[model samples]
Target: MKSHRNLVVAATAAALAAGLLVGTAGTGNASSDRVDSAPSSIKTVSSGWSIPWGLSWLPDGSALITERDSFKVFKLTQSGTKTQVGTVPNVVTTSGEGGLLGIAVSPNWNTDHYVYLMHTASEGNRIARMTFDGSSLSGYTTLVSGIKKNKYHNGGRLKFGPDGYLYATAGDAQTSDLAQDKNALNGKILRMTTDGKPAPGNPFGTLVYSYGHRNPQGLTWDSAGRLWEAELGNSTYDELNLIEPGKNYGWPTCEGSCSTSGMTNPKRQWSTGEASPSGVTYADGALYMAALKGERLWRIPVDGTSAGTPKAYYVSEYGRQRTVETVPGKNTLWLSTTNADNNGGEPDGADKVFQVELK
Candidate 1:
């Protein structure tokens, strides 16, 4: 049976009417030198969708997102309208936890208009690239194939790092033991070229950048070019790890704490009850994590490569937060929801996109 542990107990009609809600996380001491500013404002953009996953902003201030179970990619404009851009192919939609997942534009997208996607395919899970004209997609190409898939452990987050290469997250397909196998792509962070070949200068000499991940779903970099990932643990801990090439992260072996030697420890971790960190991003010297099971937005300050205490926002605020992306010009965070899941509360058209302003 799938875990149904993170649902909210009650709901407010006003909060639902306003199209907003919140999640919660534990607090800790400040490890980073800089402190996070208080949250200034939180505003909802839209809701009434199924499981909304990946998010990417367009140049025109519009945004594109994948509706997992629906197998469609939506374009959301500044004025708060949603239009179906294209149907994502090969998505094997599963209730609550799986379907069309992550989306990202080409690093050179202005010229190529290429967008990439990670989804659970008919055979299993796969990554593909597609091109989008102003109105719709023109072509599609598979980038990676033959990945195993299951309902709950599909780690399908994709991002292009500052270096212009794509980094992908893969889950162990519920086989926890696969996380420790360096030769396998499952349960690992992979660095690859746009064509899906192992990236140059990778420490492992294989597609694996780091191994021993449970279900990594978040990837982002700071202004200083450090890579961070958010991972979901089985039933114990959820983690935020600072990634290093070729290092092991002790999944299935260690859930929280730096318990294993020769493995990189998480900069921060929370119990499964506290956080099921999904998507993460760095902006204004802090890392923002979107929690699914935990249902809150967490801001962790970063000093160099280390993390500080985390501040929670929207705890029981919304229902279940899915992804958080940073908006460049405004210096605010854009948060999206995951209300269609079984454990999620008030399942009627409640998923939303929210803008959080840092004071």
Candidate 2:
């Protein structure tokens, strides 16, 4: 049987809704000589998810969450109620990191009511669309496929940009040479319309926007419409990059920042252990990154294309943060923990969703 645990007791949900679980200390590392601002509150919205990989807010203020291992999708209410909507069909869950991963609500959801999903299948990783009826999902339509997949390194993060185009991240799937191949769809950030066709104004005639990425999982656009990405490095360093159209981010040739010609360097880089950053969100003039291996949340201020020193927060308090999204029309964020994954080594009921007030 599929393990679905909803452990939100009435008392716990009431306490969290009343803001009784707020924290006011900077338990993690602060930036160089700069004091960290305390978050107004941090409360557990719900718990007992199994490796929740994707989170997307609906127009009605409810949220949709995807479980990576279970191939299940859930609808979470603000008052701490979780209902299993349905599971995506034909998802091939692998050992390391492959399954139903990222989800993005359609930009015209009020009319179209379509939701997009990225998942690992029998042939490779693919993107598909489904009709969401506000309670359950139906009508799975494969939009794009055949990117390549492996036990690890299937970059699966999807988002609808402000321009109403869908942007997706694709890893090299252990094929390092593919990052340098412009013709290959692997190791690229692809931009497409809702119908999965290449978006107009693309630098290439194809769907490839920026190429030469190893395993980029986080993507967000800044106030200036500049795209930012968080990438996992091989063994040396992880990177926070500013993406440009038709640009190439050096992968096999350069792990982090390099002096190689015709390759774009990262805006900031950190050692592998310190920052295996995943889903990122841009809000209130900063980019918030969820760290998996570092077990913390990083706040990096952005001024145009430049980035300042990064500060850590809630380190080890929430084991292995996976997704961080800024709540619409509010100064709060929705954060999801990934402690149920193998890398976290935590028991069942370790995964949770949190509501955090930004300072």
Candidate 3:
């Protein structure tokens, strides 16, 4: 049976009574965290939706959220209102982990009118640009191409870093060796210009910023502007790596952390059953990770380059958490689920997005 969602427990949630209460999303129970964490008050902001893969907030505080299989982009306002802005065209799914995957509003969206999307097309996975005049999508242009894609590992998360460059996670595409290949694009953290060219001062003088990754789907920066990544491992462990330029993460050779000579190890690691991590965001001196197979949200404390022990929340309470991003200028997080993932068996519109307040 499905438990009820959207009951607010504190006065903090009442501040959202303006428009966040307009839709079916409701403020839920105010419960203490499992352990040494803050009181987390959660409420559903949007429901009856599909797999909302990529979430990027705009300058106006509204957000553009992408659906994985639908190839549609929806505009979500602060008042909990959802609208279909436009559909990203020419998107094809691999029936596993491909489609209109990641979306990022250009840092200068107001001036450039450009919205970037990383999707699977007929050829392979590509990063493309489309003109979104705040209403519809037009003028499709391919920015970066030649990244391989497969049924399982597409590594499709995009974020504009503090340095103003676009960073993307490219999976190994079921081919492990390609991760260690310096010339190939797959299984690497790519830093590129807004124009889709290799960013200036790259380690390999190419788009590849770091290599030897498996299927990294999450990217975020701390207050210090240091990059941290979440990677899904093969059979043993999932990794939360402190990403560095031109470093090896040891994918096929090391699942989580190993004694490899030149390979960098994850700051913290988890068994696969404990954390099949996807999207992660930073807030309140911690990294919030959304787990798909593990079905939980992990809050890991960060002290510079070191990661403290992880504390979990909503374990098995939600089906599958997919994307977690910080609400800009707020002490809250927006968490999206992926219950409609993988197989064609699960019906669409079974997913929901929640507003988690770290009180």
Worst 10 residues of 3 by lDDT: 21-30
> Per-residue lDDT tens digits of candidate 2, residues 281-302?
9887778888888666877777
Candidate 2 lDDT (Cα, 0 to 1): 0.84
Q: Which residue pairs collide in model 3, if any?
A: 6-26, 6-27, 7-27, 7-28, 8-27, 19-79
State which candidate, 1 or 2, has the greater TM-score: 1
Misplaced by over 4 Å in model 1 are: 1-36
Name the regions of candidate 3 deviating beyond 4 angstroms: 1-39, 343-345
lDDT score, candidate 3: 0.84
Q: What TM-score would you give candidate 1 relative to the actual structure?
A: 0.90
Which regions of candidate 2 fall more than 4 Å away from where they truly are?
1-38
Query: What lDDT tens digits, residue by residue, belong to model 1 across residues 1-359?
Result: 12332244334334434534322222233455465564689898876777789998777778889988888898988667988889987778655467899998887878989999999888888889999886887677999987778878889899999998999999988999899988788899989999989999898788889999999999999889999999998887788888989889988888766546777778788777667889999888888998887777888887777777666667666768889998868778889988767777546456888888888
* Candidate lDDT (C-alpha), each: 0.81, 0.84, 0.84
**Which pairs of residues collide in model 2?**
none
RMSD values for the candidates in order, in angstroms, are 5.0, 7.4, 8.3
Which one wins on TM-score? 1
